[model samples]
Target: MSDTRLKISLASDRGMIDAALVVLGTVAEHCSAPLELHFLGHGLRDEDRDRLAHACDAHGCALVLHALQDEDFGDAVQVNENIPLVAMARLLLPRRVSGRVLYLDCDMLVQGDVAELFELMPQGAALGAVRDFYVLDQMRPGSERPEKLAWHSKVLGRSEVEGYFNSGLLLLDCDVIRSDRALMTRMTDFAAANDYRYMDQDYLNVLFDGRVFYLPQAWNSIWGRDRLRAKTLAELTWLPDAERTPATSKVIHYTGPNKPWKSQSKLLALLRGRLPALMKWRRAASGRYA
Candidate 1:
């Protein structure tokens, strides 16, 4: 079997860092691969680095810190949030490493072993993305007709455009990413031109389009108000002592404003209760492995 690694990018911002640590810890426990937590952007304090190192130690994961100086990229504009951070990581892909790297947003949690995701990489595509559930009808101005949002489905050529895919979770083929300069340039250019809603995600859809393999919805299952109304609470809740089942998804992405951390929704509260315990498990597992 090919070696696999779990990769993520984050800044030193406290909230995002804390969230990243929690998710990283969760991923470490669930995945057997070497975990590579790549820290990008600025303000990463020594103490923060130490804390991350300690956490990685406990989990037996290999942690790599890539301090990206401003000079690394020529004069590209930068967004401090998840979008640009993700784009930066993508730009640095296929690093001197072998096999594929799983890039996950800091806001996600791994519910089960994601080693299987590495097996899903398409031979010709640079990466795989999940269609964004939120873009179904909100792509255009509210006053404009709903049909405008459907433009992708109507006018977009299968080769140039397809349904919008969320950029939060991705499985990138390092060889394809490193060899295809045009693909990287196009991703960068698209982000520069259309710096609007969805950020990197919108640009990614425009760049890769039908070229990307659409992974099953379960892989990037997201939670939001719409999901709450659509599925029963029992369906989304993660129970303690529950064995890890062979589910379709390798990760669960909390894509929108309503995260399990700050949500007051009834369903969110129930899921929130399990987070502390998961964190505890991560810490313990990290210590044993480190």
Candidate 2:
């Protein structure tokens, strides 16, 4: 069982450590499977690492820390100059870790048994993820929206329905990544060729192309820019009717700029009654250890 325990990977910087702590605390509260957490970042201070290790220890989970510097990736990493180097950490997971691992963004909270997600992965799917709503909108341009460029298509020169998946939460088959150097090379090449609108996410969609297994939205409920456009999973036609409500969601992702931590942000206020779970995240972010 120890060998098969779920492995979770999180990448964080100074600004996101609090959010990461909140995620860790939430997992402590609801996740029932034996687990291991891997933290990747360029500036995880010794004290912070100690604190994180202690928190996981209290939860009876194991923690592994990788203090990486920007130079480690050479120039293969792609992100805005303003984005933290840690933003590229997910790209390194294939080479840095072993076995199947789930990559989760720090700006999310676990609300149910995470092992359920792990168990739901279908065999031969290199990765499993929920559809990114904003990307879906771009892919399915409508009345007011212009069609996406042909380059964004799976066929490259031709337009095809190549859905995009968010990288924020991924059930990765690390063995596949380790064995497929061509996949890694192609992703790096793609990153170097053009500036992606969504950083590594764009590269991931391009690299995987049609290989991704789209999980139910309930697994990774995302918060988009215009709440009116995607206030709930029900609003997205891409989502299955069965997984529509917040009550059924296993995770809530603060995907856009308006984070729950920004107590004063008007965007957070828009969440209104939908943010009771955020209160739990906030408590965890404060280092309360749930």
TM-score of each: 0.69, 0.82
- Residue 23, model 1: lDDT of 69
RMSD of 1: 7.4
Clashes of 1: 4
Residue pairs that clash (backbone atoms under 3 angstroms), model 1? 57-290, 58-286, 58-287, 59-286
Q: What is the lDDT of residue 5 in candidate 2?
A: 68
Global lDDT of each candidate: 0.56, 0.69
Worst 10 residues of 1 by lDDT: 236-245
Candidate 1 per-residue lDDT over residues 1-290, each given as its tens digit: 21444554444344566667766777777876777666653446787788888887887777767665555444555553434443444445455333466677766767677666655555767777665645432432233344545545543443222257777777777677667777755654533533544445555666666577766555665543334323322342331112113333456666655554553455544465444433433453453422
Candidate 2 structure quality by residue, lDDT tens digits, 229-272? 34434344655653344346677787656577876554455455
> Whose lDDT is greatest here?
2
